[model samples]
Target chain A: MSALDALQATLADEHAALYTYGVLGARTSQSATPALYDALTAAYRRHRSRRDQLRLLVQEAGGQPVAAAAAYELDGRLLRSAQVQAEALELEVAAVERLLALVAQSSGTVREWALTEATWSATWQVELGGAAGTWPGAPELA
Target chain B: MPGRPLSRRTTLGSALAAPLALAACDIDPPPRESESSPATPPPPEDSALVAAVVAALVRAQSVLDAAAAAVPSLADRLGPVRTAHAEHLEVLVGAVPEADLPTAGAVSVPAQILPALGAVRRSEQRLQREVREGCLAAASGDLARVLGSIAASTSQHSAALATEVTS
Candidate 1:
């Protein structure tokens, strides 16, 4: 696989990840719900950078950058005020799960790109909501 | 029902971007175990890398084992998954014949959230660090696949634990 292709893959996964956190940020209070806000914002920046990195790689490889999608399927809540935080978590976890599977499929340069994306996505799982931040010594939910 | 198709409005920005970001979602491909072992070589290629994987798997296995043992009724699902991990461990151990992946030995899994999370976090962090470092040390495409698989599994485990806390 090529670097451009891997970057394209990350662009998509991060897109979903970003969308999910957006929902989570709205539903619960920071103090009560957890500082998932910080995690989400960090993810947004990381993903955007990855998207850009992919573009650079594509440009270097003489290939056109992969474009983003029209509208993503968030956990059925786009405008906030929805009971979709858990659903959003599920979606993000599933997205990262898919990326892990994709990395297994690809090889060479593309695989390298896949690994990078998967590693970061997993970190979000721990940091944002699921396990990492949930436990003590974990980033505070307070 | 079938999912939505890649509509025209779903520009390269929307459709393609999602796939790229989640591209690492994958299973750990098995390591290539040769019919014969190699001789010679100094320092070794991936001692740390292999150790990291071994540690993660063992810790994971223990967590699953304890969890399954605690909730023995869930053996229906846990049984198969445990078998799968054992097999995976064998394959991983065989990959680096020279080194023995460290066993958890006597690490106790606390019944409470704090200690439990701490144990899991340590294992997860170790694997994550290895995955990051292994990407740099990998000599073959297969190794990368295995590393990715292990990392994903650890990620899933971490997420699973978090779900318990939330519930």
Candidate 2:
């Protein structure tokens, strides 16, 4: 994909992530599941920060950034800790893939930023009871 | 649900000022042909890049195998890690002719749990560093993507292994 296209995809994933965390974070309480709640809140803020940065990126690149959806689909049954962790893992996996694409298409600090995010995603996976697998992003290659 | 259309055309006037914005956002503009650097050669093909990745995978497999045999108690935790390396090997081998990849010798396992886990963790950390460097050096987009993912995977493994060794 072109650089702009990759950035747009990353922006879209960030939007989805923000929405996902907003849903899941509400269910997690600071008293009941402090770690998970903190993680979710931190992820929400990170996604929002990246989303805003990417919107500026697309605009600077002479492309229109896509808008976020009103709501994302999720089963309310994912109230359990394991279920929420799994959902977070899935979102990170998708984000890593898009970030890897951006890494390929970018250079300088943008590439560095993507690499940092990729590492963070993998670390998060281990925390969520998953291995980074043989491949974190490019499973098709594996 | 569908997203509501949000027109950002209010910023249309900012297009003329995009170059400064791009710089501020760390988005470099496309380089002109005349401004291309002559020092750097283009990215090598997949086969060329596969050698380093394959070497790292082989070393990782050997280390994990030895580590597993040494500390049977940690086998459960190490099992998925070993499998991950094997899968990486499979993918790397497919990138090039079999003859080009190195044949790894079996390394002897350490006698104790901490030592074995430590060895495995060190090997993983080394592999992570090499793979990250390889990813940065890779010119081919596909090769870079694979290397980047491998680097991320190795980082994950190394981090978890560190915890295993300590805890």
Candidate 3:
């Protein structure tokens, strides 16, 4: 994948994450837990910012940024705090995969950015009680 | 997924250097019939990366083992941390040629919980640096991706350990 392709893929993931966090933030029961609502809100903002950055990256690489899907398929059973955390963990892991690809495709400052983003996603996974996986971004290889 | 390889490609004027550049790439192109040959040895930098990864895995295991033994209260939380290191060790070991595998000598752990956390955090920071350098030095894209993923995991481990220390 080219640097442009990696950026586009990351953008797509950011969009899905933004949408999912929105759903998670709105669920009254999930938000009722102390600090859960705040965490979701912060996550939503972070994704939005990342999405915007990815757009610029794609454009700079002379590629048209792909648009988000109309709707993402999220499980309806994210009722409990643990379930929500798990879902969030899944999303972060997905982001890490794309970011790792970017790291392989790009170099210099672009690679540095991708590495930082990868670290951020894995940290999010850790916050959600997920293990610091051996292969944070490349599970297929693992 | 390799995009247009931004670097490592030789220009027209550098045709004379093409052979060396091609040799730098780790994977050998398929040989024609009756020309079977063994794989080339790993470059020095790549071998160094494998050794660094092994050292990191050992450090993590040692520090976590000491921490768990010292603080029984935090032992439960340490399970996943120890497991993560072990898993990382397994994957990294698979990267090294059997004959070239580096030995990871034992490490001493701090006695107090706070000091142990600090030791683990410092070791993780060092490990992250090694992985980052390994990613930058990797000859193949796949190797770079793996090293990058490991670096990211180290970052997460540091963050999680921080929370444990604070809480």
Native contacts matched by each model: 0.13, 0.46, 0.50
| Candidates in descending lDDT order | 2, 3, 1
After superposing candidate 1, which stretches have Cα over 4 Å from the reference? A1-3, A12-39, A73-82, A101-116, A126-142, B1-52, B55-124, B139-143, B155-167
lDDT for model 3, on a 0 to 1 scale? 0.67
Two-way DockQ contest, 2 vs 3, winner: 3
Encode model 1's per-residue lDDT on B1-167: one tens digit a residue. Answer: 00123232222112112222223323222333432122322123544555666776787778766655555554454454355457557756665556666767655566654555565557556756666466445443334445565555555555655555566
Query: lDDT per residue, candidate 2, B1-167, as tens digits?
Result: 01112122211112111111222223433443332232333323334556777887888888887777787887888887787777776666654534366877878868798778778878888888777776665544445566788788878877777666566
Which lDDT tens digits does candidate 1 get at residues A57-85? Answer: 55664566656566566546444423444
Sort by TM-score, best first.
2, 3, 1
TM-scores for all predictions: 0.50, 0.76, 0.75
How far off is residue B7 in model 2, in Å? 40
Which residues of candidate 3, in runs, are more than 4 Å off? Answer: A28-31, A78-83, B1-40, B65-77, B98-108, B165-167
lDDT agreement with native, every candidate: 0.50, 0.69, 0.67
- Summed over model 3, clashes come to 4
- TM-score between model 2 and native: 0.76
> What is the docking quality class of candidate 1?
incorrect
